[model samples]
Target: MTFRDVVALWLVKEKRATDVVLAACDLLVAGEGGEAVARLAALTRLEADIEVPILLPEVMRELDLPHHSRGTVEGREEGLRAMAVRVLSGELTPRELTKWTHRMFGHEDEGWRLSELDDAYDTQAVDSDEALDAEVMAEVRRITS
Candidate 1:
């Protein structure tokens, strides 16, 4: 009915989805952020090819939303490493590891992960035992001499 609505419909029909998002972003900054987001969401529902990191994120940033494409890779790896340590220490069971890995990494199956952690634990346990043996031997020699 209105000119703005007509242009928006045209942009969406033409598959210029990014332009539609830009228009939505302007509406949002004009204190209609909610309505703009709803309109943009409907238009971009099935279209994933639009990469308007600029306009869409402007609205999100203004609204204090997390707008990044992906989370930090280093942080995710560090969390997994800490979780592995807990598993090796027997503080976390295999079932718990599977559950947590599923939630965090979308990995529902963890056979290989459990095997790797078990192998690492065995290697570290052996190294610790060898160090303790050397220390006891040194103490014995010192006491005898």
Candidate 2:
């Protein structure tokens, strides 16, 4: 079944008739594009948190939800850009930036991938005990831009 079908079923199962959910599902089914998908995804995350694990992977490929090792999925660029800003502002340290970037592109809990970020994390050890703030920030800027 499609994502909208799954969402519609879930809404019925939960006995929910929220206009936002229905509207989002309708828009998504009709191929309305990113905003609708984002709205529906946010609604699902908020209203049906328990179902997200199953619902996301099984039904919502269009969402391109992030897995630990997935390369260059949606939102990663924006997130990295934001992190770069944080790094520049000193709100987050280089180490923390590395951790976040590694988490985005490397093994976190159960997933790993062959990626530039993973290679950097391995060789530079930026996520731990490495004072490579400038380097990490530059990399973040490069990728994000």
Candidate 3:
């Protein structure tokens, strides 16, 4: 999908700000070498009102990505690396991440339910920390570590 389409999907369909941020981060990371960095810079500018200090780091941790302090080049790079790791590890698939972002950041729909996505993707079964097996736990640790 085009960058604009990805942004539209995240904002219009996901409705969760956190999801949108995460998906955007993933896209930035997956793009061409320096392109990801440039995309991230642009996204940060576009969402400046969203407050990177309060959002990006937490989302990074949630996605099993790395965290960095705000407003620094190193922090930006680290955050992107974290996003890349999450994408590679199956912790967050691109499509699933996009869908979640659409719901999280998009307009509010009182009828929206996380379960709806659950049923549609059948992919979030791994999100539960309590339900993970030893192997899964190890993978989680590897991702976090």
On TM-score, the leading prediction is 2
- Sequence-dependent TM-score of model 2: 0.36
* Candidate 3 TM-score versus the reference: 0.22
> What is the lDDT of every predicted structure here?
0.43, 0.47, 0.40
**Model 2 steric clash pairs:** none
Ranking 1 against 3 by TM-score, winner: 1
> Which candidate leads in lDDT?
2
Q: Which portions of model 2 miss their true places by more than 4 Å? A: 1-72, 107-131
Clashing pairs in 1: none
Worst-scoring 10-residue span by lDDT in model 1: 1-10
Q: Which has the higher TM-score value, candidate number 1 or candidate number 2?
A: 2
Clashes (backbone N, CA, C under 3 Å), per candidate, total 0, 0, 15
Q: Which is the better candidate, 1 or 2, if ranked by lDDT?
A: 2
TM-score for candidate 1, please give it: 0.26
How big is the positional error of residue 78 in model 3, measured in Å on the Cα after superposition?
3.6
